[model samples]
Target chain A: MSQRPYNFAAGPAVLPEDVLRQVAAEMLDWHGSGMSVMEMSHRGKEFISIADTAQRDLRELLRVPDNFRTLFMQGGGLGENAFVPLNLSRGGKVDVVLTGSWSRKSAGEARRYADVHVAADAADSGRIPEHWDLRPDAAYVHVCTNETIDGLEFHELPVVPNDVPLVIDCSSHVLSRPIDWSRVGLAFAGAQKNLGPAGLTLVFVRDDLLGHALDICPAAFNYETVAKADSMFNTPPTFAIYVAGLVFQWLKRFEYQGLKGLAAIEQRNIDKAKLLYGAIDASSLYVNRVHPSCRSRMNVPFFLKDERLNDGFLAEAKAAGLLQLKGHKSVGGMRASIYNAMSMEGVQALVAFLKDFEARHG
Target chain B: MSQRPYNFAAGPAVLPEDVLRQVAAEMLDWHGSGMSVMEMSHRGKEFISIADTAQRDLRELLRVPDNFRTLFMQGGGLGENAFVPLNLSRGGKVDVVLTGSWSRKSAGEARRYADVHVAADAADSGRIPEHWDLRPDAAYVHVCTNETIDGLEFHELPVVPNDVPLVIDCSSHVLSRPIDWSRVGLAFAGAQKNLGPAGLTLVFVRDDLLGHALDICPAAFNYETVAKADSMFNTPPTFAIYVAGLVFQWLKRFEYQGLKGLAAIEQRNIDKAKLLYGAIDASSLYVNRVHPSCRSRMNVPFFLKDERLNDGFLAEAKAAGLLQLKGHKSVGGMRASIYNAMSMEGVQALVAFLKDFEARHG
Candidate 1:
């Protein structure tokens, strides 16, 4: 067997090896259904069961509130930038916490249908803003719980007026920790990061948030329509959903340090983040610019103190079987996205490499 | 090995077994990259190469001209309904040829963004209408080349004004035949049907049609935006693209009935359609409502002369390893969607079962 390289892609990111192997085993025929999950019609009974099981497993893994209806959607985080405003804004005022690039793009896209008001901006700091001007009558407040590019994460969700739904894009850090459903009215995450694949976006919308979409909202994307149809309104990314279901099941069985599932995964994520950040802080050759108070647990962005080592570091990392560590183009530094699928051993290997490289370069 | 059942699902339909096997084989590690294709970043070299090769192969298979930019999009055919007008209509009059269920939905959805003029309606005949009320000032003319539910197909594309771009929703029959690039402006198909899976959409838009998206268009779905970004405006459904690239490779090497590649697939489709249609035509127990002149080659909706036998027919078909032969709820009859992946032998099996069932029940 070939050695499995540790993948650090932001997303479509690494999936659990066990989940991938299980998916491969069931690829030709899903549970003796005589059809691959990909081949079954969205409306067919076989696919319906697969979807139902997936939705159920996902709900269990996330401990999604009973009031929150999980809709399997498309268009990713970027598409949802436009989709969120179109569906929830109702051509009204939308308050945005411009934490980083993701929220900034969300606010920019929201301007198409609504009057976008940046309640606070943290572009320079690459952290969640300390201040926010809340508009109670505003349609919703958009936030990025974890900024994939800026490597900033909100340790705690911001408090907004009860009237305004908190639409959080947790694309990068979803599933790494349990979301506080009590504070969030709608939380959407593209599955690529922590869930499953690129094509499927998971929207956990509070039941009350449905049906407020403006007339222009595409019916297929309308939260009300999608929730009512159970996300089968249009063919709901069947294969992605199937793979995600496997990941969810794998998550349910996940255990580490005597903890289980979400708790277990969250603990592991914390450890991985600490170990990597500890290395960076201990090193004279590397630095992470984000405020440690809101540093992302899933995405660790670090730079060589000597900028000239960037290419050499990347090349050597690739040679050492660490892949996709190149940071987003918006940020020139390196970013290692250690999602749930990324095991602790992988991060340890990366840390070892980082130390070895620093020893030689420093 | 368990018998490979014949799946006739409308979309999210059957895939080539060989492609499925190849995908399964590479499920754990893609070409020793030590990561599944689903885990690779869309912008990464590995996934980018996969997307590019898929685009190139599809272009070659369809004989798509140089001027057309092949975009991998999301939101499916329904999403494209809104995406189309939002991008191409510019809030102007958009002419539509309403052939059946699919086109009706298209025209209705377009009315939100444009003054949709139903240039042609074939609801009564279940075939292409003769006269078209094409307006020269219209942004583009919309048509569903194959109406999946209505079992109607346009034998010939209408000769609209040179100023009007002909946008086709060829979701169900895209790769089944050669497209006349001279007559098309933009063609979009959700990959669920003839291609690999759901959640991925193939958009072939001419270069001249770029940059006219309305302010309301989501940058992710905007033709100009997506075209410029090589469909990486969002993650662009990485897994779906990899599977589709495999399908394209399968199509490139396909040989049967003294033909090769697209020619071979088209010939097989022609033969399959004829065999099934002939069986229905000659049968006393079954009836195909579609007009013979424009019956769909990909989806054939047939009814039992005795409607009471519908349940029995579906049950027997399922028992005989013919799955998902049930018609769409909108059309209360059996629909046999013999897509590109449906072999000639599969159609023959269906025909054989049809005759045997008729002898038993009729």
Candidate 2:
């Protein structure tokens, strides 16, 4: 909108402009307190109010059940890969259904704390597998609801064996739609994507999963201690949490015709995904490899039939004011992550760019 | 400052007004890049530039030698309590000097991973101990350069015996002065204090200490992996890093006529500490229990002789716009943390308030 490129980074991605403006206005003095939020102690009244409101608003927004405890954690999604096992695995065998890159990494990290077994792999399906062979008594089953790198996502959470709990790494596609909590025991996401900032991690765990950490688990990272202290066990990331609270407030006010909040965003996301994927599918030069059934609505990783044009395509795209459109290092191509903050105009501009690039290079 | 109270929270504490303003101005789009720093990927060119510049600027500001690797870590001071032992202690006997609350807690956490031995205790000395019984062959000797809650600090780093790495948890006083690297192998601090934000932790470890991590340490947290990858082994707290970079630039431009950079800050801190501590020592009604030799230049904790007036004192202080003056939950009193961002005017105001309160209640 300001004659700059639309960013499509997966995580550590965009935030709403409204939130940014509010943050700017309140930077020097928050509510006439003459102290920035960063200067307040986590235990201080100002920061305490911020933390409490963040948790309460998040709970209301997600419709998180009464039995679930929402925790503000650190150490990104990868850091939690080991922390999740350290707390829940108890050195017991656990099941992981590898949908994409994130799930694979989660299982690998869990191997250090638990006897990990892969229950399913979508590698054969070229998408997130619909089938899951979960162990009945496994300590927990891990899954990545949305894979940022692989552009694959599980449309619906798998029905785990009643004896096992489901822990999800929903970092990329969280808050885009409503989650069915019936099949999940724990849901976690790094806040860089849809929420607000990069440092804060949102962890929603059922209350019963609290106390079973391995002795080796650090006290600061132990779920039981964090939950007991209301996530202030140690100094939580106060500023990041404050920013995330602002994003939640923004979400509460989001509207679209007859829809509002999550419903409104869900409708927009569905429309955006359809438009881009449709454009990609219709083009002879552009191709997306993931199966249609599990194509991610958040991240769309596509490739050109001719790989050599990748450089030129990216260069021209950048010049045309579409930024950060390159794919991940491991997988070479292009990825466009149209998060909640990205508008319909941004996507339309992108679509227009895609058509123009195809016309020139085809 | 704008009729608001002074905030003396040890951490999750105050940041610079200029930096906060810059953050506000660029919150929506960083330098016309059309993306919030939060929206950029860790590996993208835009974010890579940010990461590189921040690291370079910090290294220059601290005069960090090339032999040391600066890692941007998570888990705060407490999380690093676990991470340090897991990465550097490596089941070897680790000698810890109990300076105050932070060192004691670090020792307790290290016990899970290694043979933790307390080499000295200042709980009796009423100060952080100067001499330590550090083991000659210990993996590392740990100290807290500044204890936030106890208002105690080591004015100079202890010179441990040969090959015994000295690890200082400088969480409360990092960048407030020039680090004595000759006697130190590793120095770590949470960024919330004098650095920038709550989620970022800066760890400076000598290169030689990189490879000896415990086998059970999480790969994402392993110092060797992080150091080798330039702290990009995982998705970092991108926004926090950018803000910290801005702070580093601000520090570069800081001047105190004869002093510049950290030297300017150190002098400012010395002056601030003298003002508040002098006021406390001058009044019979107010007392600071810590030994004068090792009083923290950052945190000044003072108690009213009449404990009955504590509540009323806090209430009146709040009315006077002195916020977060409450001490740690473990120690009930008042503490004022004057980081680099807390101006001398703020400290003078607090001193003025203390005098008026003592006079009214004496």
Candidate 3:
């Protein structure tokens, strides 16, 4: 209840306080059952309820049609990069749109399983690519909807060949906005960012794409087997799934400006991004290099005009109770990841810190 | 803690009170960082120390050999059943020794990738198979050391073909005893039981068995790729790994009677099993069906003599704060999973409840 620091960690980022409190209260005993949620059997009736409702809520939230199956899996986004190619690619040509670090990594890992081709690369712009070369007969086209490191995002998905499926790694920005399911054949994200915690990966895949896995696909990692078993083909990450179920419930009740559910959260995210990006654009001392049109709403990476004050800026930010504002080591600067849980108030406080820091050191 | 419930839910079962207390205390901020451990990046120096120390302590406790690489992965036990075949089986013949439910499941899942052979099965004796019929040319031999559902176990591993490696799913009883590294090619366990939580799988594989994954293996599940990147090839289940690390630290400092570390824990486990099994044997109202030699030291499944009284028994058990005593649906009865976190007092409490319930029923 005391003043807590505002966190801006990119991937394993800040979670909603309500979710944390709920977890704490349920740690000793869940729902008067005299056992923690962690202790329940995945197959038991109690846990079955948890799993059933989580899947149902997620389906409703995503407005997923009857043809798509959602699976709660393990391994993070990086794991899915190869997992995606292994299941969808048959050692055939696969087109990859390299938006930033994550998409590039995905293409590199996929090379072991498929003939990978980078249809687009935005390395020069340090942003999401605006143009993509279409490969009509490719197995699938891959994209990272939001890249945590480069601060690039594909607001509008690219049009790919009709024969090719589209795979999106939406790890950093999942649940923050509406996804265009028509443009995506398979989408996967780690749960650490906007969902409950680490360890759980949510995979949304079309029915037709399920059985195309290469002969060597691990049954557990195969989208077909997993979808058939409802993600219970394996002993699931039970506790993480249970927590995520609770989060879906929380999202169902979330409200903002007369809009409820995911829509409300999406609006809040948009507003938060606008406030922070507006401040950065207004300041001569701070600059975000990515094109304004394709900037990530979830992650905003920027640098001070003078790089010498980077250490000082971080130290002062920490002292002011603004935590984990440092950007990735690969890309030096500051990153403010305003996830679903990050309040407008948190962003406001961050903007104030940025201004104060600039006044002191500019 | 005022006589809390005796929790015996298998895996994600019971956690040490000390660990729970420490987690609660650190929920707001870890050390002076003003950020939850969950909020820290896996790449951060703070979390690197946590991940490194956990791996180090676990190695020291288990005395893992230099030739083996320990990787912290995601996906629960069942997921690994497929992941194992994907990484090590290479679609060749896989020999399986089915002691109980878990091994049977493993063999069934492996059939999707390999020409699976039942090397041994113990359904007749309600125990672990005594003699394993290993294939000299088998790609790998799989075993589940502890069967949580059936209360069966293979306390001592078998001598297998030298050319064929042994892969053990030690999910229910890992770290309870010293592992014979010379015989084990790969040992994997889900963290929910003796480790920490669900969603994390600990895989200790010999370096030599690293790179022969099937072309269909999901890149993330490939042991060679995971090892090359030190398990950070993707964003790992960071929070679970951190908690598992804390458990390793606790085990290192543990002492019992003149014994220390794993030796001490094993002795305690043996004593707890003896005490409870003895009570069950002496009582007319309750009975354990497992063969005496293979009865698990961790999970003990027993049935009430009067089948009609099962519901009454469970209701009373919950009322008495002996919780989650219901057996798995596959096998109808009661199961007591006294994992490493369960104390001697907890076992005594459960035993006392059993006696009281029997006396009333009689």
Candidate 4:
């Protein structure tokens, strides 16, 4: 832990240190199987166990309903932006709620497959829209529950007015907190952020939402095809799934402040986010403009009030062992993605750096 | 190498021992970055360098033309079956030369996206089609250069008529031989076979074939969109790409029979095929039924003369550390998939085992 740097890049982000160590130990021989997890056949008993354990543990962690089937998939959130419409839109109209960058991209991509109408927009305020114009005949309503790029999150999910199923892109903040499964018809997240590695995408879809794929949808990406096969329609990202399974195991046994499982992690995330935001609020040289109620508990995109000090702040922070503390180009001051892997100690260290840097520059 | 088994699973198959060792050593941290490659953002400098090095090395190894762009993608061969037609078929007709199980799957998937015409069919016999009635008005001609399950391969590519672009599924034998680029327009290979792992699909497409995708094609799977972004259209399977880059580096530095680069690998593959097949041909107890000219050099599927010895053969092989020797369920006997990472030593040992097993049983 002493030799480690706190990585803060959003999506393709940090994983648990314990998971990495365990993976390293098992790289050459998994459970004495004499083959790396990457070398195992997807259909082989060994890999099937790994994949099954991951699905079971993840289902347990999320408290996903029995009606929902968790499909281990490929293609990131951006891919699902198209996959959502291809599977659910049924070549008809679809409605979207544009909260930030991700929802904007989702709407744009959906238009190619269906007539995507913006049911609600919150681009100007960087908040989840409180109002909505539901299209009763639309196939589904799409919302990016958390914008990885814009540092916005929906702490509370919206209840769709129509019977239209709600598809949520919850890539960044997926496992950080519990999901209200009743409101979600489908939830997709790229594993890199809070799960494990890139290349593996996790899609949780209700069993009823299975078979509405447009003809043009790739069979492997079709929710029904993948679900029926138990996500074995194609060879899954075996290594990523194995690692994600390890993460799930770690989460299940995790203990923090007398809490366990997802609860422990959620509590830690709250503390971590609060500490950083509290420090930011107390500072004169830093700010995060996203509405406080909707500010992401997983990703913290902050801006230097004196923007010229941005580069200096990042470099100084790096020298102090804080790393990848650069903001996305779209919002150019700074961002600190304190994902599940980020510890309370790491947040303390970051807050210390923030205070020290501001005193020097102020 | 002593600790690792001789894995012959048909991919997510065996990888270079050295690559695995290096990966293990760097699993905790990469190049003193204090973050695993899996933990880095795809757009960040470290990952970008890795992505660039891999792309460059692959281009060099394949001698991919300047006009072609190698896109690192997700979704396995099955996904690309749909992706190929969705992008290049342009909602028009496409010609397919069916050789085996894989080509059969491809033609089936393409039907959803285009007017799929079977120009040639070799279903009645396990042989590469010698002739074709190519559709001149078709968007492209599709062929599977290697059939992993059927153990049939095209030693020489079919010459498509009317200058129709040739889309080849080279999944199982991609890096084992040199591809004749002039005869190919788009080549897609799931990385599990000869590359690094599953979940990362490598698609090499000519520039001219880029933007003809129908409106319904998922933007993430769109060739032009991916090419323009240099395979970073979405997160491009960062760890798999990094490991693949290591494989490319290993291939570049590999020396056998005084040959280098793809030539070295080609020679080794040719030797490996000859060694294993020679042993099979000499024995009355074992047989390979494919036409000699079109027998796959990568996947060697052989059968015991007595069907009763199948499980016994597998048990003995496993005891002898010859792992994953069971044949594909589709063609049940025994299969030894000696891809790029399978050594001549491994093949010789397998030959020795075959002889010994037959001597005891015969």
Candidate 5:
């Protein structure tokens, strides 16, 4: 393995080194097209083939139902906060379950286009709320499957009535495991985390939810328009999509333990999260406050019990080739987001560093 | 120079070879930071520095005034069609000067948010209209300075009254020449063409125009929100901005015929456009329909008199390492987009091929 630092940025986070190598190797010319993927017109057959393969591979990996239309789009998760309501809300009531900062933002943005009701509020609980007061008349129910900042995730989705489709902002934990698409009306993810690079947003919308965008929704963001054009409605972030396609290929070929592909990645993620959280729990100098039942398998936010050592811990971690361990300013201390790209070895290194630091500081 | 094919894609177009090489070399480790540019956190000092330097270099290159806040955003030109009105229109009357397809789309999208009036229609005219029906009470006057598909351009912007801000969609020709900022209020470009890549949209909005978004505007696309947050209100496309920053640096270091930077690029663009148009005008087999005075200096669309040879022309050109010469589907012919990245030699090669093909078939 390469000796590069293990980057722990929450999103726009680590990508597999092998994916980066492949991207570098192919930067000058993608395949034999004699043009960089960035240079290819989005409408060209070469790019179309790339787009199709990526969609197909992703569908196969997730076992997405045939009724869902995968739309490659721009405008990260924040953009979709409004887009979901604009497309699905029909200018009616939207029931939002406020799990953390992300879902709070979603409800806030959705209020501009629809009547928003917080079906459940768990922003401070550090765990998923056990029950939601969903309304049958609601246009949709909005949830954030993984809160990148709070380090909380939904291990199982909240049950909504069949008539009221569920919408998820799964930016951080997408592709780490399989999604339960049967209950999902739409799932949107910003590709900066586990998927690939920044700038691309993936939206999987069931066919039934296609054409009801509010007049205020931009055509580029109108789900039906994007679906019809196969996300070429507005250039669709060509380079980002190409890099993401490469990532899907990487995920497809991934093998670990006794499993393969998404199954393998899920197992690895579970192992890495367990190792890091276990170390934090056992250490005197470190702490993680989230409920174990819902603690994120991707983002593991921890703090130094002695808050004064925060800077020293980050400095020491950087010196040891661990990068971006500082926590989000909103919820402070330190965050080590071990996305699908983070290896067990990388996690082990972090655990070792944690123990050594605790021994010295304690 | 590398022996790569001359790419003639319109937007998501050709990028400087040196920039691509730098991107490739720095893919695994960015400036010894031990992380790919893609992996760096947007808030991290490493990426913030990259973003800052890029903004500074772009400001310097364009000589952007202090009153204008340059924002790095997403959702391409099509997205900006709605964003322009949503942010600037204030749900009032919007007067649009329809130059071609892009401006027409802009007008159509603006109508969704504002009471739109076609102040000038030049969609069928091969040149810019000499006059427009000015609406003094309008929120803004919209114009597409260069129509990428129609091969039409405004050598000078229409004289909108001082009170009304003029919004220009300059996606195709931005960065190829200096903007006369004094004649404009806001200038927006999808960075797929002369800038760097797709997914990153550049908006230069005057400070006075900041806080006037419609109530329904998504916060992610709200100009005031974006400006106040310095385009970090949401995760601005980090990788695209990094690449564009490199392109900006490349432009700063550019030299041609004793000219430097933007001046050098402008001169080269002028020369490249001249070479390609000159070739078509001199040929009996191909003809350019747009008026010479208002012809685009970026996209030069031409038609084969004997249309049967279109297939042969494209095939032979591709065989000779000239790529994406086929015109846009909306306008069926051939187009050579000689943006800032296209070298004089590339144009010269295309001209030579043009003559050789005509000599045998004329």
Candidate 6:
């Protein structure tokens, strides 16, 4: 019913409308502080409260252990591609499972800091590879739990032996469902997708993983330094953090199908994914190369059987009030990113549009 | 005249009211794009246009030369302290002029990547050191043109010998006035003080300085890699960049007392600084330790002769519609950061408050 069209752009994708409205309402003044959240010093009590609440809420939402420190960092996932290795690699061997584009990039970046060995690679398969050659002596095993571009996700984390910490780049799917923190030693996500904005990065690092930073690590990006300062080691992306805090609050209050909070959102996400995947499976005109077991619930990349209809498909979708449905240039097909912000109505509308478009051209 | 109090928080400082209003108004829909600026993908046309316009407008405002690649990066000035060294240091000798706390930090950070030699030390003196011991073959000569904490500023850049590049950390004073780019190889600012929001950092690096990143440098922070990708090597802090773009537009349209754009803003800044510094000099109750010639036009750190009155002064100032008058804890006194967003009227109000406070407490 809202005039705003459904936006399906991948990362830096749609935020909840309610969160956007609240951010707008508070732009000029936040909580009677007489300063926009953007204007407040990071060290101030008001902004500190905002940062603290966001951290606490995120911990609760993810069921993150008290042993982990949640860092509100800048420099997106690409920045963390280096930060993770620099902080956790200890210039030692780093094992990476290359499930998709994000994990591949993470591996490539880690090579600069450590001797990166690919534990498993499934870039062509569009699935989380079953076998992993993770080394026990490796400092950390890296994985992209959810690949935004490849539309592949891990249903569960891979087991790493000998307590080699598992580092996951969950940029595209953090907060949509509960994180299995017990399996993750470190998790970093650029906050543009399911979180808040593009400029802020969220890093959750276990206490035991701290203080192993290579001497070359930038102090600002070092887990030990950042943990000591409570992510205020430097001036944080204050506005983005505040906006993310709002998103966290929105998620905490979310309800669906008699379920509450994270469970409710997870259920809704499952439903949305099921509906879209079902539509794709039922359609002779459409094809999804990704394996069903590993297809991302957040991003559904689909192709028309007749590749010639790609442009027409996108054009019609846009006209039908569905936007940014264009697939990434690297992968030529349509990707509908049903992030937590995407409504069921939006998904239903997309499904309806896909069927209508196929009927007209099939 | 506005209900908003005058905010003087140093970096992540106040933004222009008009820009904030426009940002708030466009939060849900941006230029009929059906997506909030925050929701749009960084690579999408709408967001690209926003990024381009911001880069272009910033170039125009600062009169940046074509030879310079302006990077819209993340990580605050603290991050840049390492990034600059990583990108430009070449694991060689880095000469740093220790002006104050910021340059000292810069020097300390640079030491992690290169052999940092203190060319000059004026940390104790609230003035730019007159003499420098320049290394002819040093990688780069570093300086903090405006020290946000110690309140010292270089009115003119120190002359580096043998064409050694002069790198400036002009975080607090960038865009407040023109830069003498002819003498500088690189200039970096965290876009919180005179720009928009806290997360976005602006770097202007000469084309020649692009390719020499140390192998240990994170590709995301590497100037050459970022420049080659047009600062899109990764997903940038899109929302922060968008807001900063709005601030750029605001600055471009700004007019003051027969001056226009940056010149007008510069004139206004000079007037504001002169008014506040004049008040401090004339009052026996107030003191600004920094020398007159080298004092910052943006962040004016002042002290009360009776140090015990500091708490009372800040409390009273906050009650009187003035906020964040407290200085940095490192050099505790009082800092009145009159960034470009600070109006002449706001400065006038602060001056009046200063007079009234002095009248009551002197």
**lDDT of all predictions:** 0.90, 0.87, 0.85, 0.90, 0.92, 0.91
User: TM-score for every candidate vs. truth?
Assistant: 0.98, 0.97, 0.92, 0.98, 0.99, 0.99
Where is model 3 more than 4 Å wrong at Cα?
Answer: A90-93, A127-131, A137-139, A159-164, A211-215, A257-259, B90-93, B111-115, B137-139, B161-164, B211-215, B253-260, B304-306, B356-362
Off by over 4 Å in 1: none
Q: Per-residue alpha-carbon lDDT of model 5 for A1-362, expressed as tens digits?
A: 77998888898999998899999999999999988898889889988998999999999999999999999998899999989998999999999999888999999999998999999888687888888888899989999999999999999986798579999999999999999987899999999999888999999999999999988889999999999988888898888888899899999999998799999999999999999999999988889989999999999999898899998899999999999999999989999999999989999999999999888986
Best by lDDT: 5
lDDT of 5: 0.92
Give the clashing pairs for model 3.
A216-B216, A217-B216
- Model 3: per-residue lDDT, tens digit, B1-362? 64567788876688776676676667657887766777777877788888999999999999999999999988778778888998888778999988788899899889988999998888758877657787788999998988989888777877685768999999999988889998899999999898887889999999999999886666777899899989887788887887788888788878888898889999999999999999999999999999898899999999998999999998888788787888888998889999988889889988998898888885
Better model by DockQ: candidate 3 vs candidate 5: 5
Q: How does candidate 6 score on lDDT? A: 0.91
Q: Candidate 5, B201: how far from true, in Å?
A: 0.3
The superposed Cα distance between candidate 4 and the true structure at residue A137, in angstroms, equals 2.7
lDDT by residue for model 1 over A1-362, one digit each (tens)? 33699999888888998899998999999889888998988887788888899889888888888999999999999889988888888798999988888888998889999998889999687567777888888999989999988899999987676667888999889888988888898898999988898899999889887878988888778889988888988888999998899898899999999999999999999999999999999999989999999999998988888888899999999999999888888888899999999898999999999999989997
Per-candidate clashes, comma-separated: 0, 8, 2, 0, 1, 1
| Model 3: reference contacts kept, as a fraction | 0.58
lDDT accuracy of residue B189 in candidate 5: 96
- Candidate 3 TM-score, C-alpha based: 0.92
True contacts kept of 1: 0.88
In model 6, residue pairs whose N, Cα or C atoms come closer than 3 Å (at least 3 residues apart or on different chains), thus clashing, are A199-B237
Which lDDT tens digits does candidate 4 get at residues A1-362? 45698888887888888999999998889998999898999999999999999999999999999999999999988889988888998889999999889999999999998988999999678677788988899888998888888888999988886678999999989988999998989999999999998999999998888888887788889999998899988999999999999999999998899999999999999999999999999999999899998999988888998888888888898899898999988878789999998888899999998999988997
Name every residue pair that clashes in candidate 1: none
Chain A alone, TM-score for each of the models? Answer: 0.98, 0.98, 0.97, 0.98, 0.99, 0.98
